[model samples]
Target: MTERIWKIGTRGSLLAMTQTRMVQELLAEIGVRSEAVILHTRGDQLKDKPLWKFGGKAVFVTEFEEKILSGEIDMAVHSAKDMPAKTPEGLVIGACLPRENPADVLVVRRGNDFFGGGGKEKRGEKKADPASGPRIGTSSLRREMQLREQFGLENVSPLRGNVPTRLEKLRTGQYDGVILAAAGLARLELDHEPDLVYHSMDAARYLPAAGQGIIAVECRKGGATEALLRHLNDRRTEVELAAERGFMYGIAAGCHEPVAAHAVLGEDGTLRMRVMKYGNGRCRYFSGEAPESRCALLAEELAGQVLAALRPAEEEEDHRTGSRRKDG
Candidate 1:
């Protein structure tokens, strides 16, 4: 019997909607008919303001979560990258699509050689890979640290906006090249992908943002869709994301602090987690693994490190926000 329709919920942003469409297509492969219910989130409206100034990272996916609780929607789709280290109770990630390319790329002006992104050495800085000098733009402190401090790039600035806006700015030569997630460019069909020539940095060298390149299908706990989701769930991805989010939670990374982590599942079912935290006097790396476990525990262990990083900065924050962070 053909299922008539499953109401899928997602944020109104282009990236969120794009991921939703991809999920719907995946459902079609399994003979499920689904509909997307576009929900407005505060993150979509407050484009001008930074996320921390608002309700922190909680504001990003909270509305869709509300919809799921209210029974107005059966499932919600999310970009694995934007998902925070923690999710609310009574909801579980039902499915996560096969991850896209998970590297970050440098997008430069019409004629810049920051990694020779657009055809090998145009601006004459081609003497050698100088390891330093040139401007970089990104919204992640994690990216900044990896690109600037680690790689020796001198100029790093914050670049914020939807995908199109960021690309347009790059095309006009406003920045030497901004750091963008490779997966997003491929999804949007852009030509300058990360693998093309942009220093091909590994996630180990640059711990990815928490939940990067992972899309999740979340449903109410013990719902009718439980079995369906388990069938769709990618255990390998679940393991990877779980480990990464766990590290983030450990570090207590919310909108307040810029942190990054990435996890990978090996051929033999081994899971490895890498985390980076740069705040106050701490700039450190942590790595660990679990042979067998659920996603929850993986996230918990990663969050443990994050918790350690924030111990010193605790006095500067409000109690309400600090307590309810990743650990909360």
Candidate 2:
């Protein structure tokens, strides 16, 4: 009897390739054979603009999804964070690999003293001027908003490119610092680069995007391929991702929205989630817990609370603006 080899669709970037290889290795360990088929996506083509400006995070996965639907590939591997709030009707996330460090890290050129005396100034101490503050580069609106609002970092600019390109920009003084996911640096083994200093942000204070640091394998809803991919699913990760993504969908969040959700599963099977949403010039946060089995309901409950809190403020702003227009 001969074994079957699976065709895996993936993007061509170094990070994408590296993540796909990790998936391949996991599949191989389970006696499954697979090959990577690199697909150039629209996201790769438009590097000059931010992701939100064009079509949100879905741009990166659309081509691979089309390929999967057309049966060109048996399955597609993607960074779970890149997944949009809703999955296409015919497809489903077959597995979520064990998560990496979900925290975002701030990387700065070595010897920079922007943090004042002992790295990071005390909260509420005088803030640096936006014009004079150290330049920090990041493409994520969530990170940029948190940097300015929470960390008092005012000078953040949009930077778009792969991990290496972003780091290169920092190396050449294009930016004094950059915010990057710690998982990428660890996966690429760039966390310990001698010339760069890494400050791991507190996840509670600076929440990560939903599904951050997870690798998701998507396949047609039901078939042999789906059965095979199930072997790679980590139960804890899948549950955590479900809750986080549920929260995202509950809020009707888009790539342009500065939203974040992080869920932690404890040994006792309790699931705790922290979520953040930015709207109408304000940032709102919510936290809740439930049994692992009821994660989805908990996420929905938290999201409802968030929306309820934001609506009154939104209506008040709208009324105030309308009144101002009438006076004018």
The C-alpha TM-scores of every prediction are 0.82, 0.95
Error of 2 at 103 (Å): 0.4
* RMSD versus native structure for model 1: 6.4
Residue-level lDDT tens digits of model 2 in 23-139: 999998988899999998999999999999999999999888899999999999999999998899899999899999999998888887364355466221235467677788998
Identify the leading candidate in terms of TM-score: 2
Report the alpha-carbon TM-score of model 1 versus the true structure. Answer: 0.82
lDDT of 1 by residue, 97-215 (tens): 88776777766654456565344343324234543456666766677766655555646766778777887776666666778887777777774644333444577776677777788
Candidate 2 residue 46 Cα shift, in angstroms, is 0.4
Query: How far is 21's C-alpha from truth in model 1 (Å)?
Result: 1.4
- RMSD per candidate (Å) reads 6.4, 1.9
Off by over 4 Å in 1: 1-3, 116-133, 193-199, 280-282, 294-328
